[model samples]
Target: MTLYRDQALKALIPHVNDRDIVVAVYQSCFDWLQLNPRDLNYVAVGAMGQASSHGLGLALANPDRRVIVLDGDGSLLMNLGSLVTIANSGVTNLYHFLSANRVYEVNGAHPLPGADQVDFEGFAQSAGYAGSHSFTELDQFTEALPAILTAPGPQFVSMEVMPGDAYPRDYAYIHSAGAREKFRAALTRG
Candidate 1:
């Protein structure tokens, strides 16, 4: 019952309110976000493994709306400390979604050593997250997501996904500054 990356993301779509701010990192998430075209504000972080920290900041700054962090396993591993920070912040509206495909899916689907060995959910719990869950199948994820999203938490959800296509080259135009300005503008307009 291996879930594909796209499937896991698709399952999450129904739970997100249009007003939630999404801070996505890595290629797959960016690609998905582009295709979905949400009216919700989005901040795309170009740097690898930085989305959690950025999402934490955004969650803290905008405590009213949920802050969805669409992150990847490789990226999360790169900054495990961010989990600690997020936990310590005690932000109730932060929803950390880690797409664990066990590879750097954007970079030609390269294998990520020890990715399968790490217990990301346990790590998050140990780091003091209010809630944490892992899913390998889409059905259970779909059933559980709405409650998880609505619950008061700095919740952590680690979904195991089968790697999919690399991000399309033509859709790579969004960068850090532009993304920041766009998200900031959206925030200001409200």
Candidate 2:
């Protein structure tokens, strides 16, 4: 969570569009994106890797806009088909960033139902992302993120992240109506 959030903020330094839409898994990315929530279009999906799927809908509705999905390894595994759907559909403005913390952090680090074993980069590529890459080193991650984000198509990137405690409280339940409306309007342009 630390490294993913750290690097994501750094990566976002140069590519943030004034009206781009961003959705991150609940508690996975808000701390990072919240640094400038109003300045950048974004949302927090409480359901985990579903951010990628949600971003797909936004991208489909607003193809001209870039949609960034900040997801978690545990969450992404829960719904890998979301990736296939993205691939099979042809919507290309979505970028999925997964953090391989390797545990369900919010749930006291419990192992996933199926031994919790997975290879994110491989899974994403196999599921249809045009290009998938992994990052174990912080420097390499910062360097590669922007290119993948801005290159003009669906791409997947996973980085090894450090787990942190959950947010002090739930924020998704506190969605700002104005922000929601702006985001919805942005997508409706599709």
Candidate 3:
């Protein structure tokens, strides 16, 4: 059975800390907000595939901190070039996580093009990532997360998941200047 997105994210909460900068987009943004709301969380709104780029920037700027990017399969497809850019950027603090549901979940769950054929792990590995992993079982994912999160740089993980609990979408919050300001203030204070 495929992992549930919420369950996977829930498993991640204990591993994340204030020092870890998390960049999330679209569905992951909403789910993360609901599950682990924190000032260090950077919600990448109004962008289809920029979370990884943002995380890369954060990782580069704060070389001592860990930057985790929560990205969607559909969104990643839009910015496939980022994999190569990230792998070559020489930043070892960035961890990229792909929630592969094989659909545009936020856009009414439309099936993604090449959904069945895409090999995200292969793409990341080919693009020169230091490490690449795929997890379809929650037990394995949970057991391996600690090591993965602690391992040295530019790691990519593709998680096969399905929709989980429904979350209330706060569009106003995600799209507002207040949200950006809040994140900026928190980041600067850190």
Candidate 4:
């Protein structure tokens, strides 16, 4: 059974904390904001597939803190090489979560190319990630999240999900300079 994106993120929220830096993009950003709005949340505005790259930078810069990246399958496809870069960078504190809804939900729910055939977990493992997991059920994802969060470096989790209708897409907030400034201020405050 396909999980709902919101439900999947809800399962992950409890595992996240104040010190953890969350880098979110696209539809995931909207849902995450609604679920858990925090100061350390870095919303990737206009950068299609750079959430993982940004999370990698944050993880490398702040080795003491964990960096969680909320990425979309369609967006990840825009820069699949990021998986290799993240794995090779040797950042153990980064967790890359891909919401694989098999479509570009933000762009009017268009079907993604090779959506059904793409093996995100395999790609990460082949790219040299320390661990990789794929979950299609909420129970399995929730049950495994804690261990996954604590396991190893450059972990990849692909959750097979469906589009959720609970959250509004606040495009203006995500693209605003004020939002960026807020995140910057939060980081600097540390």
Clashing pairs in 4: none
Per-prediction TM-score to the true structure, in the order listed: 0.90, 0.82, 0.98, 0.97
Q: In the order shown, what is each candidate's alpha-carbon RMSD? A: 2.0, 3.1, 0.8, 0.9
Query: Tens-digit lDDT track for model 2 on 33-70?
Result: 54545434556555656777777887897787788777
Order of models, best TM-score first: 3, 4, 1, 2
- lDDT values, one for every candidate: 0.79, 0.70, 0.93, 0.91
lDDT of 4 at 50: 91
- Reference-based TM-score, model 2: 0.82
The C-alpha stretches of model 4 lying farther than 4 A from their native spots are: none
Clashes of each: 0, 1, 0, 0
Candidate 2: Cα lDDT at 30: 52
lDDT of 4 by residue, 15-77 (tens): 998889999999899999999998899998776899989999999999988999999998999
Question: Candidate 2: where is the Cα deviation over 4 Å?
Answer: 1-4, 44-48, 113-116, 164-169, 172-179, 185-190
The residue-by-residue lDDT of candidate 3 on 129-178, one tens digit each, is 99999999999999999999999989999999987898888999999988
Model 3 segments beyond 4 Å from truth? none
Error of 3 at 117 (Å): 0.4
Error of 1 at 84 (Å): 0.8
